[model samples]
Target: MTGHHPRQAVVTGSDSGIGAATALLLAAEGYDVGLTCHEDTAGVRATAAAVEERGQRAVVEVFDASRPDAGATVDRLAEQLGGLGVLVNVAGTGHTDRVVDLPYERWRQVLATDLDGPFLCAQRAARIMIAGGHPGRIVNVTSVHEHLPRLGTAAYCSAKAGLGMLTKVLALELAEHGITVNAVAPGEIATPMTGIAEEDAYREERPGNPVGHVGHVNEVASVIGFLVSPRASYVTGASYVVDGGLSLMAAHGHDSATGWRSLS
Candidate 1:
């Protein structure tokens, strides 16, 4: 069942990082992009300008992914873009507190933002695509923690793991409708979230990572671009890890770690 997926796309959390890069890449690929930001108004506007400079339509919206009403923002953006064909769920949050010290509110906040938000947004996007009688793409930006547990990121890891499973389940359910759902799991990347500048990505070296240097936002965006492209129409329910082999070092990371029991 092949259907024409529209070139219109909505990217959540496009103010910076991977989301921003993705919006630009999709624009370069002839997609009219709908970009959403949480708190960085200026950053999102700057991204929108860059998209327009790429000669594609860009719409900016303030989106708080943790809110229950977040899906409405996707609806509005899809309507503004004329219809929905691609939806990237990139808005996410993380917590560093261990489970013993993690507050319930913080746990809920992380889950709501990283997991519930994507579910709601994807639900809305899928309905629109189905109603339009066209195939679509939904990309969830998960973390390497989705597959590997970390020391102090209990909430974050749980949410991402849940999202990874959600992607597979959605793929199975939506295949008949001609929609493809997948996840992109990234390791440490040079973005504002990591407090690393893009120019410094190569300067920072991770001996544990096979790639040696931290990943750039464009690197991850390129993978996402291919997934949304017509070439990936048959691909779904897969989690593409963009981590520089960081997750692969799980055993190595714990080999000499006798202090792993303490959070400090």
Candidate 2:
């Protein structure tokens, strides 16, 4: 990991899973971490402890990413950490429902968190970085759904797809300020979101995933680590897919009745 002088970074939804993993990795890579959790204070505390154990400072806050004031949380975190150099928008949510049966509220919530949240956080972080005269990195944690659709992920797919395009536009706007913007799309990673604990073996033989297994949180975090590094200065307006080739199965359609029958 390379940083010109990234003293601080904010990772939203850092209570557990990929967010926690990224926070710890960034801390080890010499960054003071600003962490946020929607409701998991204990999990955030544990994550903060791990950052401190690595001799890096950690500040934790709580806020709902779907709210309009989401950017205010990042503003406060940056102030608490003294400054901000990296902003990783990992706060996101989703629901499983066919578009015909999906509730309006559910759809709104997904878009709010997955798309609106990242835009606001990136906007605030970029402003802070520019005012402070620091080149910055903005990495949005999207999903493989950004490129491919799932059976019952209408809202999730739409939100991620929108975020993908948003990432490119922001990259173009922020390029003049030396602020690189990008997205990371992961698939079937071992995380609480996927109902798999870190100790569990999420790797199962699957027809979709060519690697025949699930991915680890750290695997996704490592890609995020590199994107935010100085080495990736020219790698803006891109979405890095971190799946085990699961997304490549998009072209190969399976029989709905025989292939599998699970929404997950």
Candidate 3:
């Protein structure tokens, strides 16, 4: 036991956005955190610093979760943490191409990174947690795109939808072992994934969101932190959407002519 503390957690794609927020918040809650950034070295370092600022141990791993060596990469992180207690799958990519024109390669890229990669990481983390005799938490940071579609993002929508299903499958399979699995699906969070700037212009332009602006990375991270905490022991296979009523726009009269209506 670390003596009145949270355990070690590996937060994937934590260089920025929701991933970075998850790392920082988890650290603040007493979890030693391992952060991975696929490409952005600077964001990786920044997140590591944030973790340390919270008085938590931080290890940074450069990882591409889509590659064949992804399992090896996660294993390296597991070694650094001495074991695993929480796995946050947040590393992902986005797209802005039409379904007809969306390159098959791009679809593969998004699926591999967003869905397949997280599946592999969660599987490996589960093995380690079980062998280490720790009942753990696995929180997949999916997107509101999983249900509510957006224009020119077929690959992203498809992949996130798959991730949602994967979360449920894992919850069912890992339940007997006491490993809880859930998802945080955020909409338009101001992160690299959304490629939206955090400025007043963008905020003022978003007229439909009940919160009246795009969500911040920390908003989603707060939900993720809760899902992994001991307080969430009874929660599993569910997704908490932090979209601030943007999804409601679809239910209301907002014309989804942004090209999202055909996803059915």
Candidate 2 at 199: error in angstroms? Answer: 2.2
lDDT of 1 at 120: 96
Predictions in order: lDDT: 0.93, 0.89, 0.84
**Model 1: per-residue Cα lDDT at residue 6:** 94
Error of 2 at 14 (Å): 0.4
Candidate 1, run of 10 with poorest lDDT: 254-263
Question: What's model 3's TM-score?
Answer: 0.91
Give a tens-digit lDDT track for model 3, residues 88-150. 999998889999998999999989999988999999988887777668899998998888778
TM-scores of the models, in the given order? 0.95, 0.93, 0.91
Clashes within 3 Å, all models in order: 0, 0, 0
In model 3, the Cα lDDT at residue 216 comes to: 75
Alpha-carbon shift of residue 114 in model 3 (angstroms): 0.6
Clash pairs, model 3 backbone? none
- Please write out the lDDT profile of model 1 over residues 1-264, one tens digit for every residue: 665799999999999999999999999999999999989999999999999999999998999889999899989999899999999999898888988999999999999999999999999999999999889999999999999999999999999999999999999999999999999999999999998998899998876676778999999999999999989988999999999877776656664334433456
Pitting candidate 2 against candidate 3, the one with the higher TM-score is 2
Cα-based RMSD of candidate 2: 3.9
lDDT of 3 at 178: 80
The whole-model C-alpha lDDT of candidate 2 against the native structure comes to 0.89
Tell me each candidate's RMSD, in Å, in order.
4.0, 3.9, 4.5
Off by over 4 Å in 1: 254-264
